[model samples]
Target: MNKPECSRLYKVATKHVCALLLCFCLSLSGLYRVSAQDIELKNPSLETKVLSSMLPDGWKRFEQSPDVQPGACGITQSPYAGNTYIGMMASPDWSERIVQELVTPLQANKTYTVSFKLAYPPEYFSSSVCSGSFAIYGANELTEKGEILWKSPAIMHQDWKPYTAVFSTTKAYKYFITGPYMDTICHNAYRAVLLDDFSPYMREVPQIIVQARNSCKGEQTGSATVRVKAGQPPYRYRWEPGNFSDSIVKNLEKGTYKVTVTGANGAAATTFVAIGENELTADVTSSAPICHGDTNGIIKLNISGGVSPYAFSIDGGVSYQDEPLFEHLKAGNYDIEVKDGFNCILNVNNFTITEPEPMEITAANASAVSCSSVKNGSVELLVTGGVSPYIYEISGQSRGYDNVVSGLDAGDYIYRVYDQHNCYVEGETVINKEWRDCAVFMPNAFSPNGDGMNDIFRAKVHDAVTEFRMAVYGRWGQLIFESRNPNVGWDGTERGSGLPAGSYLWVVTYTDSKLQEIQQKGTLVLVR
Candidate 1:
């Protein structure tokens, strides 16, 4: 061999031997630090050091060049947490990474949380846009890649940003990596990721928890409590069936209730609670059927469970009342509702009212001879309502169902009917004897210009008159006023229009008590 070639080979061998010796020493140091450290991963903050390279002591680089820097990296800014941080180059086809094995393996079917500080320095511009992310892998041995248990979306920012990833695993995870996601960063052509203060710990995800507050037996204050546990605070709660924001809801019905609690960090959880039959109810009692023509019907309501100071509604939805007693109601059906302090409504649809058995008595005419003398009279009564076999008394004369009194002196007579149910009805009949001859008197004049008195042309009738009628005609016989009723009069108007002051002729006809027909004619004057 030539002397120059031998010298070059000797130099190459010495360089490799020194490199191997340095790697061996760093490995031993990392092992000792890991055994003595409290953190699951040795040198978790990247505090350990090795000379001749930009790598930390306990971390391994992956497939590409990555560097650790104290102040800046290619115009990038300083570290976020410690004295030194790692920087990696990312592109479409390749990305640099730093990976480590945890001292304690995460249990299967368990949750964990990881946090890290990251930034894309504004002074360092590669593609004008950069993004990076982190992930956890479930593996028995540390590898470049494995089954991913959790991952975070790629984030791009110029200033230091804090990010957290919460995830669950079905397999024990002993390895974790932080860098750019190759598939996403490649689209932007190239990106530089600055990572510092990488931290991983076993932490449970936010969970929505529900607790029950059962109401006392036969009460409606049954409630459910909603909460978020083991998650970030400042939680927001929403309930089903309504938009209630409180942590506890009262006066619940017998059903399932759901609540969603959202954490401040956008984590959410849902839980459910159930209520049973220990709620409020309304009991209504109705009175017996009120007899027709009575005003004493009643309905009373009783409520149990729930809070007090209840309100009521009976008109379907028209109004609400605080009283529970309903009185003077007609015989029919009604729907009732009761509400407690919690605004829960108990609806009763079967309230009923009915009429009592009927009982009635009617008395007919008493006889009289004249308008000013004593006379013999008769009273007849018709009995209705209640059971059959009724008894009646008239003017102190008692008899059976067909009650009749033929020998009654002139006066007022009282008649009463008693039914089988012992219910009674009373009535009065007068045998008048001082009646006068039938006649109708007409008014001579009237002033109907909005006057308070004497504004109508009306006629007065005497006693013993069966029927009377009066009609007024104009001077030209135009038939301006007509009436079949004696009490009905005319205002000095023709067809609802005021007539000129003038004299009008009237004719009155009537049937008298003696069955005689009388007719009279007269002139009535209108003042205005």
Candidate 2:
């Protein structure tokens, strides 16, 4: 061979020897590349601290060394992939790179797709870091960086960024190389670009398919079967909204359902299916009760959609009827369900049944009876709530047309006030007989004959009395004598005319210091 030919062969031979020696040294140091086919790209990330000159298994280096990092050269960036990733740096001298041999060669006339991620910062060292780009190349041997296959633009981001590359080849290549790319030589600077998680040669998994049956208007008859088209065996299905794992969903309502399908390769795909039904709705109107404790309240439903002959239920579907107007209802809240002929139901909640504001007697001012007598109490009521034009009644007593009733005995009495709507409220009040300390005395049987004593009938009083009145009635209920002053006396006669004497009824009414009106009545004998 000529000198030029011999020199080329010698250079090529030198490269092979260096690669073999380096590989042998790496094998001894437990740092050699594992064949791609043997690992199937296993442990794409490193588990232990690795040197800057070392590459993890399933990777190799040509002229320049790369790093399996996050622990070396002052780099602490978290792995973008599994645990550790590659870092390629471009310096003022040359761009750094890493290479690997392929088990399956890149075929001619076919396109291949792959993806990788790059990052620039958060803990940088060993060089003055700056923005940089990367490139991928196809070669025939570990000693060469052959034809450029794909190139990325400048990577300036501080966080991880992904790039997907698709390339077609005319020559079948046997190796893959990735490196930081430099258009021109940098001056006194270094750019550190991270590379990670190159996609394996995998065909895209197909999308999920679903077959479904819609629900009837109100029936839960919907069903579905989710199919994972074209993937590895042993797939797991995860359904959203209910978190079910079965491949088939049954008895569904009217809503959207989502599912995620995962294969053994750890690839996942998600899709959704909706089950539709005929719409059914209603508008409810409730009427308040006319009288308290009356069950005449009504609730009406004006339903809009679905089939005719609708049945309504206010008891949570415990019972249903065809009538839309429900009467004889009490005051309370209700949840109603309207069912169509097809048994489809629409729920309307918070249908309130109300009554009138209760008839309340705001105040009842009662004057207690006196211990000296029984029927000397009085009560006055201030009424509210029920309709106007209210009439008052006291049990077994006359209240006339007013709310104030007097002459009440010391007892528990039921008082009722009726409104114009005939809606009445009854309440019980107690009139207690109180002992008065006032010095007032009256005789039950006294003779009114002209004598030294007991001739005139009068009451003796001392302690604070505000007002007093006295009246005398004959045996036939005739008002024979009346007086407005306590000091006045009755001589058992009418006006100034003398009359026949007999047993007479005397009534006395007085207002005490406590402003209580008290009445007392008894019979006194008028001896002739």
Candidate 3:
């Protein structure tokens, strides 16, 4: 027969079978047995009683064998010794009738294990006839009814066996039907299919839990849920600031907090309940000013009215357990910071540092005075009332005295004093008189010869000189001869060695014992 003829005949046959079953059920007059044993058929035969009707309401008949036969209702092949068999196929595309009326209605928001007895004729087993799936629909008709509740492959053994599938219902549904979509190698040829005792199972929901936040306070205060599976999505959470809607509570003062959490399924759970109090307090004290050179100075900072383990910080860095002693601070203002167990920081407290006053020199002067007119004389400098052990200097051109007057100088001259602070008083004097007869005398000319006549040139001092330096230079100012002690005055021999006769200029300077300058300049001739 052509497809249209075959389809028309199959429809007629399905209507007849459905009408017979309906009439038989109606005639029973509600006298059907409800006993579990009566309902449970022991090894029901598929070939004999399993009737093939049109797919349940709202389901479209998908595939079936062209040759229909009567058969016992067994999960697999025919169970009876001799019987005829008929098979029916259905698809879920039609308003989800299979899942809505059959599978979903049985689940009711529960987990389930569903099982069915199904079989396919050997001829249907091929690469093209391999696998198929079934779905349980929900009320929304738009959404997949229940879950994709179950599925099976078209390739089944000739001997039927029970195949099972399991799924959990996340939402409730009013009706459900099982959809069986099959692939067949017999393109134009139809194949037989069978099903029996489709059953569903259910299980309880899992538990929910709450985990407390390990720490809390001020800006750094908050708690978190704990003891949860690593990737489990949290269904609900609440903190002290609010109820079930809020996941995190902020702006917390010092206090204990409570938290509660619920699982997705709304089962098994936990909560953290406690009074959170803002008991934190703090205190600060100003530090004393430190001198510039003082490396160790105590800055008094006392923290009170709070928890222990107070932390200290000079700036906004990591807090330290103990307060630090500041050292080597430049001349300026500084900010000191202190914090408690919580990460609360005190604003910058101003501390001033003053530089030590430069070392002071109170007084310095000559100790005594002497009246003298010569290059050599003695005078004691009484440099008292100054900032300790002053340093003294006599003028370089001052004759008859030491260049540096540490303890004292003997002269009729001046003294410059420097105190420990490196501050100094310009040249000062107690005696203002010239050293008597201290003039430096040198012959205007001389002759260099073997004779005992005026063959050498020298200088003479009338009084005893203390420290003296003299030098003779050619007209161009290049030094020819020099000397320090007056007793070791120059002999005009061109640095104590013989030289060609020439005219030369001489200069002499010395400080007397009284710290007076004895300076002289003249010209001399050496005739060789």
Candidate 4:
């Protein structure tokens, strides 16, 4: 807290403020240089008390003379942020301003935010103080009044206060100025305010806030949202791969995504967001159908992981149910799926409903009935399929492990075969009467000449008749030929001697299917 040997108190009284401005301008270039962006100001807090030789060290006058406040100005309050402060005011005609050549020029068409501390102390200025607004501007030169970047409302605060201004530059700016707000209708009386502790000088970069959601296992169901904060309006957005230009992106898998957001003034920022992984899995236990060709199967499913409120589908998403139990499924292979609240899906493809093999039986080698009225037919049965060791039955009669059934009548017989598991199949077979009606016949005339035509006389017995006999007699009533075989023939011979040609009498007798004897007599001619 050492006192300065000379302050601006004596210089302002003698009106030597021009001498002070000339000294600061000579030192402005020697103070510092900016390497990157216009990110900071020189002597930002006005931290100087050499009022006799300098006008706020790095600052120069743009309008009416401004005061680098000295002890005589009567500000009892300590500096709001630094060792010293500066004061500016509006005269009867124009407002006073202080400008500084920025270390580097700001990029044109880029948005920026500037902040400083301001206060109004009546005695801080030279005796005249009426309420007035504060203003900030961007300039190309230190002498000209640049375009107004921002203007505060009438500031009447007694204590130190903070103010912020955000604006887009029309051109690349070399100098920045701060002054009291003034226009045509400005206050004619003097109005003054104190400024101290400039925050910084830099283009505004928007804040990027990312909100990401997890994705489904083996599916693309995640999401992310990019929000721009503290930047210009009508922001433009972009994403990688798809080149999507929206705030929110959806249907993303487990991966990191990059997004760039650009403000209206062409200031942009890039950020990365990540969508995590979620495992959706399911296990199913099923019951087989009760019997072959039955549809009474059931499945119970248990699910784990992922979001809640799950749904299940058995018939390939055609229908869905909240419960995990499924019923009445046919015997076949199946693929079951479950969906979670986030629409994540899990599928189990190895599910089956099985039953015993169907019963198969073949009825073959059937014996025909001997007579039209008898039940003497039989059939051999072959059983396969179904479980092992099958039991056979015919006409509702259980057979003791016998595949053959005798004494089958001429009708349709219903048969069934039972597996060891009590699974049965019913089938049918028919027994037909093969032989019944028969009659014996003989030709009357046959030539005995050895010309290979009509040389023998025999009875045609259809073979359905048994116990056959045939005989022939000459005109003298003597036996000419006799035979007990139905197929045997008679020639015109007597005792191995050739006989004369004459008419002969023949008789045939045979037994029918009912064991009844049949007799028949006829006359035949023989040629010698």
Candidate maximizing lDDT = 4
- Cα lDDT tens digits for candidate 1, 1-528: 522343245345446644664476456654432211112454556654432234565576553556665432344466676667776666666556766656556556544556677776433323344555545455665454667666666666767788776666687666656565556334656656677776633344456568876554455667888765456567788888767788889876566777877655545566777776535687788775445556667889888976677888888858888899988777778998887776656889968877656776644656553433223356767766765677878756786667666555567878877766556778888865545543456779999988689988887654345567788999889888889876589988877789999899999888765678888898988997
- Among all windows of ten consecutive residues in candidate 1, which has the lowest summed lDDT? 30-39
Which ten residues in a row are the worst by lDDT in model 3? Answer: 34-43
* Clash tally for model 3: 79
lDDT of each: 0.65, 0.70, 0.46, 0.73
**lDDT per residue (tens digit) for residues 462-520 in model 2:** 33455798898988898998888876889877878876867889998888656688888
lDDT (C-alpha) at residue 264 in model 1: 56
How well is each residue in 1-528 modelled by candidate 4, as lDDT tens digits? 111212334445645665655565666666565433434676688877564324566677677566666453455566787667877767666566888777677667666766788887664334556675688888897656688878888777888889877667768878888888755453466667788888655546566788988898766889999877556557899998668899999999888889988766455777888888778777778887756787888999888888889999887988899999989887888888898888878887868878767667754556666565556676778877777677778889987667777777777888888877678887878877757644566888989888889888898653345677888887878777888876588766778787787788988888865678998898987767
Question: TM-score of every model?
Answer: 0.42, 0.32, 0.34, 0.38
How displaced is residue 90 in candidate 4, in Å?
A: 1.6
Query: Model 4 segments beyond 4 Å from truth?
Result: 1-31, 52-54, 72-77, 122-128, 183-189, 200-204, 207-528
Q: Best candidate per TM-score, number?
A: 1
State the local distance difference test value for candidate 1: 0.65
Per-residue CA lDDT of model 3 for 1-528, tens digit only, reads 433344466568677765664465445534433221111111222232444434322223322322323322222345223353333333222111232222224334444444565555433212122332334334544343334554555535655567765445566654444444433343433333545444322222223344333233344453444344321244466565455355545444444555555444333234554434324443433333233244444445556533456566665555454753555455456677655554545545566655444333244344321224432233344444335555655654332223233323354455555555444455454433444544557778887686878765666655445567878898788888888865464455664578777788988887664577888888887887
